[model samples]
Target: MNQGGNKIGGADSASRAKTRASGGGAPSGGSPALSIVIPAYDEAGNVGPLLEEVRREADALGRSYEIVVVNDGSRDGTDRALDELARGDARIRVIHFAANFGQTAALAAGLEAATGDVIITMDGDRQNDPSEMRRLIEKLDEGYACVSGWRRDRHDDALRSFASRIANRLISKATSLPLHDYGCTLKAYRRDALDPSQLYGEMHRFLPVYVRARGGSVAEIVVRHRPRVVGVSKYGFSRIPRVLADLALVRLLFKYRTRPSHLFAKVAGYLFATGALVGGYGVVRGLGKAPILDMPVLLAAVLGVGSLSLVGIGLCCELVMRNHFYVLGRRPWRIARTVNLPDPAATGMVSDRTAPTKAVQGHAPL
Candidate 1:
């Protein structure tokens, strides 16, 4: 079946509304609770509307849910809008960053504060329809830890559409996780399936890869994509080179993160073999009365030393990686604050959730 651009038409609207109206009842045991984390950057106009839509849909689902809108240092009226919204509704919260730390950082902050059985991530722009969240959650019930949205009928310009297609193909090939659309942020993830600490830079695009690398199953569903209602796209072609560089790093991390020696082993072997061949050729030529200080001899000598040096560098890298993982135990994820989190003691379970604090600059709590 062609899974591309399966639009929800008018006929489906009545059925969808019925399904929604039937929801908002008491959640049964094993029902998937949700935490919708939206990262907003200068999206003042869309912030309030997005939250309202999410609230309506999430409440209709009859699941315990919270909408965490991370204000990514928006210079606009986004902060004011979030403050007014959060003051009235306890289910809505905001995390105000000290500066514009990019979307990935904003997402990392939101994931840390999230306390739900399942976390939903979407763009702050209204382009990602909230109605499709039900579809993602429905697919998540099929024993998949992650459900990514595919914008089959994207509404962007031709250049962006073409660039996105190329980027998706390259990322899928590099990560070995074939996804139709990696740019869509509308995805549902199991609470324990991923570690937010492993994310950095624009690595949010590789969330599916990270989940799969941890042995978690992933599925994709076609979701409705709308044109932007406000603001401009922060991304451009200039970011492609950065994405390509990050893709290479992600590939290496996924392949040999746990056993880094696997990455260096083959390279080391090749380097040593090349060195041996070049040195051996030089020695063989010497027996035929070839000049010892000839260009071939010097070049062979350089190649031999270079190979040994590369092997040494590889060993050093392996040790550094091992020490960092075993000795230091570094974790990259951080949280500024949380709201309405369940009490661990009353629940008879302790979580990695940190203590809450107010908004502040630096690594200060909240």
Candidate 2:
């Protein structure tokens, strides 16, 4: 691999040979150096051409890399297409889920299977050009833990694009990550910078925040975005509500990831204090009045009960979080396929280290 340790492309061939000799299918001794993970759902028409284009681009970068494609229980011919592609290329690996687990789950699977110093994630649809992968990798060379791609000139229809912009803005504000295009799937991440276990729901869009929460830095770069050539967009207007709902969770994670009890306690405490004050007022007023059977007494009673219930719920959450982290040792992500190869150190974006000395030939820009 690149002796510089931070070089964008380099691999230890000797270590890889040994790994293969021992029956390991993935690069060994961290040889691949780069891993590209694509999550596909009913992308039968796109996977084959997408893989070819990805290989062309990756080869141009002159890096030893692996391409991992996750078939998210596609009801189409995606399975056969991936099978055919993998048959001809050893660097290509395909994983199939038993049922459609959504994009977040599919991406998590790919991340687990990835064995590279740097991991790259992109959409399986043809919209994200493979040639832009270099831009993201180059950004990674700049010592950032994560580099996100911003589709500056989105090619989607007007309504979809507008909705995406709103959602992206909301997420940026909620997580305090300040990313321009959280919806863009094209992003590059350093191996240690990513915590796949911290992701769930549609929170994949908050990857930069997840990494930043662990003391890592993030950056954004402009990349080409094309209209989908095949397969329908699985997302629609309905996803907006789900994403908005997830933002609350993201905010909680931002403020109290390691201390769930803090958030719950804070809420419970507020409710309890408010309820106690109101109930006390009602009691005093009722004692001085002719009768207490009115809205004020009922409201006070409801508040008191609600406050108690909130406190109890908060306590339960505290216990659950403790068990989740300490007792169960549960992870946020899972992988169905692993190459288990030792990969080389995936480096950051630094001109001195990652800039290609010679122009890569025979490659056309996508």
Candidate 3:
């Protein structure tokens, strides 16, 4: 992560000085007990009021809190607005991306930068109500590693809402983590429950699923959703394909993340069995009166070749998966600059830390 932003405010300078003096632990004061992370993209008109609402709710919590906002290379004045917000408030931290790296990347950067024991994530468009934060935190306190938000009364258009319902059902069925709203970003997580390295390509929405897979308890609550009042929606029907693709990836990881060859080997076994049966029939006929180079023999040969190819591919995938477990330096997002944050190296971004593998209560390992 690069730290090369043009400095603008005295508050940011003062916070940086305090962080440096503390040796990247916490600022002059104690570390925040809560960290709210919001990812913004072209939401210049929305984030300002959103942060104000967050501040109000955070202050009401009576815990030391910091708001970490990631500017996702917005062409609008979103960067300037975030800078202005961070300029005055020492608790507001702004991370600027080199370019638009999508919401997952932005969340990854914010999670890496967050120093709180409890972290909450929400949208920047102000559709998620700040008043609902207390409900999520209370649920988190009930021995749950994750508390996801369910937008029961969604304010989106009918078509989008229907699409969201279908997507949520499909994701729930595929990942086996039944939740009403997987698309909602208004979720709270324990700092230890999140592994920022697993985030990429719209995987932010699957955080609860990932946590559950790692044996962390997850709970969902009905949250209030308001209509977008300022900026345009960043998502649309175009994201449907991407959502489906990421869902498939999630299913694959859930079932075969540790042993991918088993998945491939199962399919290959069926192909090989069918080919052998056909080849046996071909040989039986050839031994009687049929020609050796018959259609059954040719079909069997094709299936046999395909089975062998699939087995080879499975082996290659196993090797790739093994290597992935050993290498963790490849991150999906790049940072252009940061305000009121220490270097990424000191924040465990490149550390050897791994997620907890114990199973959560009432959930069996897949």
Candidate 4:
């Protein structure tokens, strides 16, 4: 799974096409070694050139790769252009969505169709430089499962930058991932490092945090950013509210990453200890002939109820978390097979179908 853009070559459609025409059976596992997923909204002007650049870069590195263009319900002519590109280039594949989804869904869709062991996701608007692939891929050599790109000098608007700065600060305070750029789209991830379905919302910005929650390590590398030459930025200032909400979710995830009980015990213990001190003070006043039915006594009574309320809240939260925590199943099991339950008849004890489904290919849900 040499994805941070490392050039690892293996069997791919082009090679297999030639091999089969020569009267030889396509060998098993003849998929591309890498998949570069680009999430495009209305970037018709940028898509073709970026796709070509990534293709050339992957080829130059001597790796077999597939470039998946996820045309996420753009009102522009982006889908038509992508369809044409897919028609002419065997290495290019297009996921034409009927309506505009979000970028996260677009990335998920590309991930679904991606057949490569290493998957690289980049913004199709051209801000994410293709050349940065090498740095990200090189970092993969150090045993990191995911390499998130850091844009040191982002070329976004002032409002976007301010929002990003505040979001980055919140994320840094909440999670162990110390990268300052959580919203950067130029990222490379090992296929097995993440469960495509385990993501949701504006939560995309905190993917590294989510990975670490599941026991995977992520690294970061500086990347190049360019101003958007075409297409409107799909992200807007309103996203500041969503990012803050996502920050809260990420913080909760990090706190309960391993055992869930510790989070509850710590908070509950503090509340109870505070209540005990207040109650003891009230008792001492009453015993010492100080005003027994004073404001201090009432405050102590309130404190005791507040502490009990906190303990009860903790219990309820623990139960809710338990249900979802075990839902992930017994740690890692290779999935052996996924039943979807709705499509139970689909065969293959271990179908190579994960990459073919909507979960990995859809955008934003952004």
TM-score of each: 0.71, 0.71, 0.75, 0.67
- Per-residue error for 172 in candidate 3, Å, reads 1.1
- Poorly placed runs, candidate 2 (over 4 Å): 1-30, 258-261, 269-366
lDDT of each residue in 128-166, candidate 4, tens digit only = 889877667667545566778878788988877887888
* Candidate 1 least-lDDT 10 residues: 357-366
| True-structure Cα RMSD, model 4 | 9.8
Candidate 1 pairs with clashing backbones: 336-366
Q: How many residue pairs in model 3 have overlapping backbones? A: 1
Per-residue error for 162 in candidate 3, Å, reads 1.3
Q: 161-242, model 2: which lDDT tens digit per residue? A: 8988888888877776777789889998877666554455676887777777666667788788898777788888987766
CA RMSD, predictions in order: 8.6, 12.2, 11.4, 9.8
Ranking of candidates on lDDT, top first: 3, 1, 2, 4
How well does candidate 2 score on lDDT at residue 277? Answer: 78
TM-score of 2: 0.71
Q: Give the TM-score comparing model 4 with the true structure, all chains together.
A: 0.67
Best prediction by lDDT: 3
> Where in model 3 is the C-alpha error above 4 Å?
1-29, 269-328, 345-366
